[model samples]
Target: MLPAAAGYDRGITVFSPDGRLYQVEYAIETVRRGTLALGIKSTDGVILAVEEKTRKLQISNVTQKIFQIDDHIGLAAAGYIPDARTQVDHARFFAQSNRLIYDEVVDVEGVAKNLADMAQQYTQYAGARPFGVALILAGVDKNGIGLYLTDPSGTYIGYDAVAIGAGSEQVTEHLEKNYRNDISLDKACVLAIESIFMVSEEKTGTKHIRLAVIDSKSKTLRMMPLEEIENYSKQVQDKESQS
Candidate 1:
């Protein structure tokens, strides 16, 4: 086992002798315990899927994992819900501010970069702590469809497809085998659903799954209806049975 970072382990503002921030690493581990959130970018669009856990008996069934940052951008987060909400709020503010200032919607990459920069600031400040969330952001811009993953450390990267949270390793392997560069939006949605199913610990049904899709042609970001998701879940199960 690796030894703990001497002083850095106690605070986010501290860096160890090995140049590691133990507090940031600990925050990332918190995200790993969240439900799965995955994204895939395809020829026609991008799809984001997340597994929703119903924590309380009286709570609503609607999943809170997926959120909209703008008309063209959507985000799904894996980690503490409160931290996710804080990040999402920040993203919305930046996106809107850019539009008001530039008279154009903020591009997907721009939004990701701004959020990453903000998240990174928390790690460098003495009193602040890194967000315990990893975000999967998807959207359509002038450059076309895009997908990005941002971690608690404020590091962000683009991807054709990616997964976060528990069982992400298995989900990544599944994506590698099935992902295609020329995949269509419908196929991408199917893959996203399948990936979530593969990694989720609980028995995930349609109601427990939430999805967001950004269509390049329509230039719209919309959430998949529960009914459609239910149908897709049935289709995935049928295909698995046949296989």
Candidate 2:
């Protein structure tokens, strides 16, 4: 026999009898299956990190999931990468448009809201499928540091520290237990590495990791080099030894 949800699952615009949108839920599920990605907002700045598995022969220098949306805004993604690229392009255009029109950089929350609205529209339209991804958006702006998560449901919420994708429940719990509002930017980098090591397959190396920082001092986005990431990993290891 066919299930009750069988018919509704076929259309993005259709809702199941229980008022649930199966297509949207399925899109979110795609995010759950992706690798780990997280963001941390420290007193001095924001950190964006992601774990990306690479082929043994593939180039490892280029990051596949983290993106710089503007001078002060960056994001880490989990789920269908093509979808992430699409959303990022949209965000870049929006950010630039805001700059041209307002003569000011777009705030982090504004970009989050814009992407969430775009994600939501796909749910109401018949021929479109929801974006199969979720993003951790973090940056520094006039209001100080901002961190937010945007999901396939078109919902956006702010957070001090947050993780998404596989094993995020465990990772999020770790962040909640250890996160502090006054945490320093350097410590936050180590903490991000520790959180990823808790679940990532590449436990001992910096090759699979990608990091970007938007600091209050600079108010600009910059990718961390492998050498710097290695230094933070050493700190993580030293702390583990002490405990």
Using TM-score as the measure, which candidate wins? 2
The C-alpha local distance difference test score for the whole of candidate 1 amounts to 0.87
Worst 10 residues of 2 by lDDT: 1-10
Per-residue lDDT tens digits for candidate 1, residues 158-241, read: 999999998898899999999999998888888888887776665457767888888988878888888898888887888799
lDDT of 1 at 120: 90
lDDT of 2: 0.94
| Maximum-lDDT candidate | 2
Model 1 CA RMSD to the hidden true structure, in angstroms: 1.6
Model 1 pairs in collision: none
Distance from true location, Cα of 235 in model 2, Å: 0.9
